[model samples]
Target chain A: AQTVTQSQPEMSVQEAETVTLSCTYDTSESDYYLFWYKQPPSRQMILVIRQEAYKQQNATENRFSVNFQKAAKSFSLKISDSQLGDAAMYFCAYGSGAGSYQLTFGKGTKLSVIP
Target chain B: SQTIHQWPATLVQPVGSPLSLECTVEGTSNPNLYWYRQAAGRGLQLLFYSVGIGQISSEVPQNLSASRPQDRQFILSSKKLLLSDSGFYLCAWSSQPNQPQHFGDGTRLSIL
Candidate 1:
């Protein structure tokens, strides 16, 4: 079984600043995928970004970028120019590449954006 | 575009009551459907997942059970609800592995 760990329980950042949420996973499979999901007060899980274990290049989406260190098994999300809309509970999830539909998720980190 | 629908938006059931929740996906075929229960501050706990109609996989042993009547319709039911079942229930779908899952608005279940 694969496990995802988000060491940070809560993180805060000032408006326009950058914030990074830490995530690490333990998996024996070399082929897998990592994901970051954002859940706002509405409780909808929104896909922030995804990283493939085989791909060395990190993934980025607008202000959201992931520093994926495959060797260290660390995949962290960096939110630049943070906005108020970014306030939510962030989760780190792991998925197998062997055509499995199950996704293991971390406890989650609560992000607060201060104006 | 593919979308997932889960309902009712909120449910209130008394302990030992029967419970049912439905989820459907549109604009996609042969999707992998999943049911998850989320507790406050904790992440999602996968309850059940299905690959095809009439094929359901149970992750945790509990009073809950899941069924797939159609290609895209997934149902979660309980013969006798327990107070521990009070939490947010979410339905999600993915075309296959290595794809990001899309989630519905989710149903909040409260057992009194």
Candidate 2:
């Protein structure tokens, strides 16, 4: 079974600053997908960004970018120009590229944005 | 565009009462559906998944049961509610097995 690990339980960043949340996974499959999901106080799960294992270049969405190091099995999310609305619980998930519907998730990291 | 909908954003039920939560997807066909539970201060626990109609797969043995009556309709039920079952239940769908899942707003179940 694949497992996702988010070492940081909690992270804080000042407004307009940059903060990175760390994530690592244990997977034997070479082809897989890594995702970052944000859950706000409303308890809605929102997709932040995603990275494909076969792709060497990282993925970015506006202020959100990922540092996907395939060799090290590390996929981290970097939030630049952080805003207060970014405060939420961030989760790291792993899924196989093959026909698997399961998404292994980490406990999650609580992010607090300071003004 | 495809969208997922889960009913009763919040629900409160008495102990031992029967429970049913409905979820439906629009503008999609034969999509993969899933049911997950998020307990207070914990990560998401996948309860059930279905690849097609009447093809439910249980990930954990619990008081919950899921059914896919139609291609885009998934339902989660329990014979009798348990206090331990109280949590945030979410319904999600993906066009394909490897695609990113789109989640509903989620139903907050409170068993008294």
The TM-score leader among the candidates is 1
Per-residue lDDT of B58-111 in model 2, one digit per residue for the tens?
999988899999999999999999899999999999988778888999999999
Fnat of every candidate, listed in order: 0.78, 0.58
Per-residue lDDT tens digits for candidate 1, residues A1-115, read 8999999999999999999999999999999999999999999999999998899899999999999988899999999999999999999999998977889999999999999
The window of 10 residues in a row where model 1 chain B has the poorest summed lDDT is: B93-102
Model 2 steric clash pairs: none
RMSD of each: 0.7, 0.9
- Give the per-residue lDDT digits (tens) of candidate 2, residues A50-86: 8888889899999999999998999999999999999
Candidate 2 wrong stretches, greater than 4 Å: none
Give lDDT for model 1.
Answer: 0.95
**DockQ numbers for every candidate?**
0.85, 0.77
Question: Model 1 chain A — which ten-residue stretch has the worst lDDT?
Answer: A95-104
* Alpha carbon lDDT at B105, candidate 1: 92
Window of ten residues with lowest summed lDDT in model 2 chain B:
B94-103
